[model samples]
Target: MTETFPASRLWRDIPDLLFPRQCEGCGVDLAGNGTLFCWDCLAALPYLKPPFCARCGDFVAGDVPGDFVCASCARRAPAFDLARSAFRFDGALAEAVRRLKYRAGVWIAPGLGAFLAETWRAVPEALRGRVDFVTPVPLAPERSRERGYNQAGLLAGALARRLRLPCRGVLRRTRGTKTQTKLSAQERRQNVRGAFAVRAPYRAGNRLWSRWFPPVEGKRILLVDDVITTGATVDECARALKAAGAEAVYALSVARGNG
Candidate 1:
């Protein structure tokens, strides 16, 4: 559903205030340069540097050579081959994302997407070239109806545009699950299980699914989201994509939350 948010529309002319102009990385007044963040916030935006887990993209403290997997990943690998994010979800970053998710902070999308683009550019050549389509984690119809906009969808659109790829909604939530926010890591994993399915063609003479986007079979799909807390949601999404014949599925998020 198109979010005709009264607040968003009311302050359309005042772009700075339409969706918060303060720096999400830090509570500072924006420079009014359309960036919505101060230079300091931009510098401190916490890019997830290397020596991390090759599987789940978590930060590894010590020097762990090439393709190293953290102990957590070694125990159990996520469904997606690789998952990455631009920042660790803590302090200002967490607050920033919360604003975007709960509040109508769509303005943060471009900045977040650009970070994902940079991460993608740094991926291995072989893996990078395999990405054929970009998609977002599907929100349940009920939650989407309540929020009037999906934060992941908004992030996917911006990130795909930055990566010069088309954004496609190729997955759909099959069931409504409890919010993963307050759940423990194990609870999170269980909560999202079997919650998603690969979206099929809508066959009512509608171009909603099949006609608009190509089939998922044999394609390298990049799944986008606002955050990766437990790897439960995106893992399920990747499972669905793989079941639908996608050769590989990668997950990207704006931030990563430590459990």
Candidate 2:
């Protein structure tokens, strides 16, 4: 005669058995815990340190006596007032983001959101108070529908909650465009160019968040995203925000991709 376990035990184990949670970095079973990377791999992630570019947030080598500008930013300035990221998009962080992006890994958003919140808190005091509202970088409607949810939107909402700021959909992607992963950096720039626009309502009083704040008109905005690659995407997003009478635009991300 076979013996059965308690109902409570069986109920708790169902989800794990049906879909085992494993480390995104090492494949070790995560046991019911909601972390993408196991302890060891998470500890080994290469977190970004200071001396990065003031404009694009790229990691810079060597010591700096004062504010330094990366060659890329010097060549062409970004549209946003400032930019920062919590971590460099490589090693464990990169893998985790890839899974979060391509593998329906919404489970990882909590941990990533913590990193993003910490990044937001660290924004310089001089830049503080200027951010009137937070907005997520908009995805093309076709891509957003395909994914069923926008990862950047998830991050922005989580971050806004942490910062006690209202998250608003101030920007919209004008149309569908090609994926940026396969394109060259220059190609990536042109692909997203003119793809974003500030919606009419957000230009004045926002219907979704009017009680929280008057509107986006002539207000500073903090643009939230999952990662910053060539800075082109956020730059374009900022361009649209500025055009919509945003006094200034600042950008932040969970990870900063290689320049």
Candidate 3:
């Protein structure tokens, strides 16, 4: 049986409908519309133009081609085999993401997930087959309890459904760390180091490994996150997966921070 929500209950109880819709970036009232942002606001967002670094997905100024890496990526390479993002985190897009992840705007996941799927479709064919399972960057238990949800998990769930892939919780936060936003690049790296652990009893073929044993043998994983800033969190997760014998690990984000 299909359960249906009452129209009045939906409009009155759902925060996205209850509150007057507004542009996440500029806070302009959108009346009783269901869209998160107005048309003008969406058009004004700083969409990532072409000529981006192939490795990190950061915008590149010059006309470079063929698997280019950014200056920062060249200095210290990322742990993940490859990384991709939907947009450069700036202007209205950044504000919308912030609200979705930090301010409890859970209703925005469908739009964000669809945008990510569209971007992933543009990736080279070589990468399309490397992703076996889609997993979100896990949040600490305490933080998840406080937030009532993990935005990355929500995005990953939607993306996995769209891509026809399994969504699994392969990695877990072993220790709580300070918010990466308040830290410098080097500090962010240090903060997330050794912060993640692969969960046990992982399903492998027709067998389940013992809780005391690792089961990430020869698996290809696609790690999902809301945004990539310093790349520290994903790096840590990748390192843990590699240590557990994952064949390959790639990352995807809805946006990449401009810093």
Candidate 4:
């Protein structure tokens, strides 16, 4: 007897044999594994578990009672109603985020975005709220031109598609600032202050190209980003969104940075 297979399967196999998929985390040949990561790297993903902040989603160190909000949130609350992340920014997750941001590893975005969508679904409805729109923390015009793309926007689009929501460009960066990597939390907050504005609707040369003005007033929004550190950036974005009459804003990111 002769073995048989579908033509579509054989066609797909050609690419797998010609150019094997590599693990996004470690750049290892996938060896027919259908995932973006190899078994080891997938298992090593630093997923954040419970016992975290009720507001900021920072991982708590020890056992805590119900509804633990971190000291940072208690001291100076974030502008967003709530926030959460899927993974801790370290090891494989950190490398993947860096690659997506600095090294043009846009291919890694879909996987990261999937993780974000999964994390958001796990949040209780009471906390996550009714998200009306999904939007990215905008990049400044100059920085955006230089980078060629916004990593946050890519993540936001992927996440919104999964959630079956309308993704819109609801905010714009008003100015460019220095990197926040080495800045103190206070400095970080100051740097991004008044740096964002709600992107207003505008008409382009082609009427079809024009964007519909986002109806944020009295509506909830979910801000998406690649990572959240001091939460300053997202908070600034939330500030702008709320000022524009958004009822509530919640932030969701692929990973949580050490702040």
Model 1, C-alpha of 152: deviation from truth (Å): 0.5
RMSD of each: 3.3, 7.3, 6.2, 8.3
- Summarize candidate 3's per-residue lDDT along 118-228 as a digit string, tens digits: 777788887556677888999988878767688899899889888898788888899999877789889999999999988874456535443323356798888899998
Q: What are the models' TM-scores?
A: 0.87, 0.82, 0.81, 0.87
Candidate order, TM-score descending: 1, 4, 2, 3
Model 1: pairs clashing at backbone N, Cα or C within 3 Å:
none
Candidate 3 at 236: error in angstroms? 1.1
- Candidate 2 structure quality by residue, lDDT tens digits, 85-148: 9888888788777766665556677668778888877867875565677888988786676665
What does candidate 4's lDDT look like per residue over 1-259, in tens digits? Answer: 1123345654666665344488877889987455567889999998998888999888878799888889999998888999999999988888888877875555667777788889999999867667888999988787676666888998998899889998888788888887888999999999999999986644555454334445578979999988899899999999999899899999999889762
Per-model clash counts, in order, read: 0, 0, 0, 0
Mind sharing the TM-score for model 4?
A: 0.87
After superposing candidate 3, which stretches have Cα over 4 Å from the reference? 1-36, 202-214
- Model 2, residue 104: distance off in Å is 1.2
Q: Candidate 1's residue-wise lDDT over 1-259, tens digit each?
A: 2334565453673565444556676667765555646788777666678887888888867777787877877898777989888888866666667766776666776766777888877888865556787998988898787676888998899888987888888888889999787899889878988889877745566666565556788989899988898788888899888888888899998888752
Q: On lDDT, who's better, 1 or 2?
A: 1
TM-score of 2: 0.82
The candidate with the higher TM-score, 3 or 4, is: 4
Q: Each prediction's Cα lDDT score? A: 0.79, 0.78, 0.78, 0.82
